[model samples]
Target: MSSDDPLAAALAAAGLGGVQPGDTRPPEPRIEVVSDDPAEPTGPRELWPEGIGTGVGSLPGTDPREASALVTGETPEFPAFPELPARGVGADMIGRTAGLLVDLAVEVVPTGWRVTARTGRDLRRARDLLAGDLDAFDDACDRIRPHWVKIQVAGPWTLAASVELASGHRVLTDRGAVREFAASLGEGLRAHVAEVAERTGATVVVQLDEPGLPAVIAGSLSTASGYGTVRAVRAPDAQDLLRDLISGIAAPVVVHCCADRPPIRLLAGAGAAAVAIDATRPAFTGTTAEPRALDAIGETWDEGVPLLLGLLPGTAPEREPAIGDLARAGYDLADRLGFDRRRLARLAVPTPACGLAGATPDWARRALTLSRELGKAFADPDE
Candidate 1:
């Protein structure tokens, strides 16, 4: 269903937005919230981590040290959340998460802020949890009172890659299961978008999390249960599945990946309004391949996809990498890609490569502050 609104049509046609250059759009910071922190307590009492736009439950049994390792790639002291609670907390999850985002938006967006919430991983059983989750999310927004809101759910490919089959194998290997899962997820998302928009009176922005997407397409994720390592799923074919997911929402869609090698073209073709990525790690190798990254960046830029570049590190200050250091490391990639600093500026939205749930409270706050500062530096017309 094509939108009659020019902005919607333009965004849908191009599939993204380019960097706003020298154009002094005063920084209207919308607090974009992440899902799940494995290190914090999970009780209902709302606790907003410093610098985060909203509240989220801390993961159980995850040490601050171990969580830091997951984000920074250091030796692990503890394990990450193997599984999060997903059986019956649908409405509650929606409200808690939305309330959390609203909490953050109130602090960040001065003129007005967009509030959003993320539905946790356990989407395979979406059919069971969908309606309740949507209802709870809508109710939560009524309490928080936000202007714009986002709803996030795990994407199909990632879900297919991650979810276990009844046989204890991966669902990705079963085309039928994949299809069913995609349809269910799409249905849930459609209902979710409507509830969020109507209940919160917010412009709904649905972001699908696909951290495992690049690996899934690259055939990097193999079956640990001996289902013969999963094979690469083609993007053109996958686009149909993705299109269904995108089509369900009447609002703009953002496809976010923690992986370096995102399927940018497929996402662009699938009608994504933006492509959010973690650029903390290099996607391509040495200086020789910088051009490819630049070209990829340019293609997405030309297609109107804004690159949400992950810039902040989630670990402690000791573990965190400097932005200038990261920028220099990305210099060849940026230069080779043929993106002028200005173009890069327009295209980039710097952030931590992933969520800071693993970091200590101090680290999370610092990460947010650093991300904003780095974004300012990157956005400056002079630099």
Candidate 2:
């Protein structure tokens, strides 16, 4: 690679040129090692020390204050920086994350968000909206001083797949651009995490949402012209990028994919503490769940990677939902995989099956309330 190579220059320009984020180790199980001096504690670290259930980032409302109040009120122990995509424009997943990028900028086009030469109105709006959300969430936290808070961001593959290049190709199509954005995101997130941590005085957890990853791995995404499909991203390559991103994060990172056939094993190997998925999806429940998918999930759990199981629907169902009914799939997974039900509390968290941005306001509130109930149920049946 020449020093003047455009790819190299772009990466260097993004502050990622010669930087290795942290000591990123390959995902492995918690193993006890025999040592003479003070033996290191070999017990698995508790993933959730406080109250458990939380939403998958979004809700139904356009007002950040109302949404934050609802979120922190119901799921105070594990409240997320509520995402109000219903507010439109720069508030959607991709656009909102653009606000968190350090050096890159994006503008919304007819096709969707695209790379831009400089910071534009769309980018500024994203930043402003996100800033407003932070303020709203901060105020909400002031009342209930939770010990930990969660914040979501788009994972690199999902971000790349969603945003397009100036040439109209997806950013994931260009390796250099993918790394550049990933680096810029990491730098931006470091600052973002520090600020949130400082403001709330709580351990801030990061959730990396990867809704586009399954399609990227399968090469199923259509080109802008719809005449072709993007080339499948190899698993190792995906894991490498994810590892770097996860390692750089000072806070615990949860990689979430509510899609069918999420690459569970792949995500498990990428150094994430947990893999969040739609527990209620056909891919995860009953006879419909495929053998390979079951195996992938089983393997992930065996490696001590906790599963953030989305047990209830993001949108409310017709019938009244019950605690036992909401927890059936979780119990079944354990039975199918030969895990003790008692261990589910330590290994799983209850969340909505997906983002609740499309849910009715009533359902959104109900859903999170149920999540809290489900969390308590998972933790102790005798409670």
Candidate 3:
């Protein structure tokens, strides 16, 4: 590798201090939280304007300029950081997140992303792609300055579950490694949030996307060999690491799990300012939903944690549903759970059911528009 290749040189230092592969050193001190107090979602309603709408990140195309413009124009009230996974490797959720780690780096392998001895081309590309996306986002918001902008990152469990350690096993399989990664992630995210806030002139609210959490909790994810299953991560350990990360973020944090049965109770208890869910998911549908799920939702609302309700489709449907039809899920849940429907207006934000990277350009735009409309309707249903 040439020293003139600035990106690779910078990333090599991160992965292993530019030492030849297979060297080792202690990670920087574990980042500590200001307060050890119970992390009680320090901000939800306070950070979010009631009923505002946003996206779940990721659009179909590779053009960050186009994707950022769409999000900024359609949901100007609350724009989302655009992610274009179609750009490949470094552009995907996990790869983009790996770019933010302080002293940790991951290289794409034939199997998947794996920890490496030195920074590889894949790690540099990941950082480069994400930097380009952020540049595009910054340019899009050059004119209109929204007070709040939402950015997504892979949560600890998801990150641990996705990346392979040097031993060829998942990171979560090693408790010590998991702690180090979590602490490094907290440090990296805080720095990222600060940079975004400075460039965008808006308060950055982080959404930790945990689509892999359910699998981790259920011990359903396959091992590297595909023969055995990883032991289920205990609820308390997940919550504690999450709480520690959240407390250190300083910015308002939202935990998003679009899985069919997101561990709502554990997330709410972990001190997120808001909990984002796919309202259209089956586990959240009427009576078919486990009673505990409904109870958890009710309890979350009662506790005043905002819900980023994903009421619209990630991909466009053959028949476009009415706003009322799309919103029925939230209404029915509240009604069945015995809460005033009006509370949703004050405590919910509308979004697409998931990332729109798979959606066509038309559906992606339409979904953002629908989300904005639902926000208005949720805030003022009579209209």
Candidate 4:
């Protein structure tokens, strides 16, 4: 690879370059290691609010107003526009993204929501629910004036994986349908971001959730027939579609996937300002069989991109982890990656390991408090 290649630069910085036989001397440090794209932002902290804590979207219950209040009050510095999936079909990820489609509609079916030839009551309900959530978000923000607010939607691949074509096949199975959906999603998100900014008086950051992406790329999505899997999507094609969708949006973008082996490099290559992953998962903690995942982490951080590390448990645990315990895990990661521990504060944002929608109300509140404290510990461990 050329010296200017971002992957090469990251590999060199992390001292992961290939070595020849009989080479005993230590590798020399490369001073110019950096992102291949000069246009890439300095770091995620630049786009993120000064506060270090945020949520992973979904919260428990059906009331948007209550969810918004809790999120803003707990994570005042970097509050996320709460997603309440517990509200049912239209309020889930696919239903929410379908609501954002410019000229398309979806209806609930026995299998799930499917693309419809025309608009219907199902689509209307999705839009209405989303609007109610936005209203609640605006009301909550008006009192606190958060510096930045985050909103998440299903990314193209996950959307395609979820919705079925009229023919009963997944939209991802048809190349043309995939492209059309991406265009519609991009158009709708641009308007959504603008409206949130207008209403909340805060800079908007968009997060593209793709929990189903690994399955999509791995050809593991069950065929509509329930006996087979869809064909795997090539890495380049997936990256290109994501890049196109992200480029069209006028906000800092974060790609989040809680998959055990999220395609970290592919997401970074697709123009994400930050990649969110469940850092507490075994794959990232060096206990899993996959070593490359850890290397991807090192390379990502070395390229000056920020990581939204999911350090807090999403559900209630027997007992919550202490601030020092969470801080130690971060410091350990830095040491393993050969980076300075101080970089954790500048390059990481603490979040729940995943969404807290399944937790009891009491555990949910405790999780957010712990997440906020973890962020504070990252900034000032001694305190």
How do the residues 1-383 of candidate 4 rate in per-residue lDDT, one tens digit apiece? 67797876776776766533355666576798778766956433457643388998999999999999999988888899988889997899889889999998789999898989898988999999999999999999999999899999999999999999988999999999999999999999999999999999999999999999999889999998999999999999999999999899889899999998999999988999899999988888856636788889889988877888998888888987778988888878888889877668867888998889898878777778877888887787546
Candidate 1 lDDT tens digits, 253-298: 8787776567777787788877776665555546434455556767
Q: TM-scores, in order shown? A: 0.60, 0.88, 0.87, 0.87
Cα-based lDDT at residue 353, candidate 2: 87
Write candidate 3's Cα lDDT for 1-383 as tens digits: 57787765876767754655465677778887698687777442467677778999989998999988999999998999999999899998999999999898789888789988788899899988988888999999887888889999999999999999988899989999999999999999999999999999999999999999989989998888999999999889899999999999989899999998888889989999989999887667865777877788889988888789888888889899898886776677778889777877777888999999999999999999999988887876656
Model 3 clashing residue pairs (backbone): none
Candidate topping TM-score: 2
- Which residue pairs in candidate 2 collide? none
Angstrom error at residue 60, model 1:
9.9
Which segments of model 4 are wrong by more than 4 Å? 1-45, 49-51
Q: Once model 2 is optimally superposed onto the true structure by TM-score, how far is the C-alpha of residue 373 displaced, in angstroms?
A: 0.3
* Tens-digit lDDT string for candidate 2 (1-383): 47887877876787567544452445556899777788667886546652379888999889999999999999988898899898889999999888999878899999999999999999999999999999999999999998888999999999999999999999989999999999999999999999999998788989999999999999999988899999999999999999999899898899999998888988989999899999887877877888888898888889988988898788878986888877777778888999887778777888998899999999999999998888888777545
Q: Rate the local accuracy (lDDT) of all candidates.
A: 0.54, 0.88, 0.88, 0.88
lDDT of 1 at 1: 24
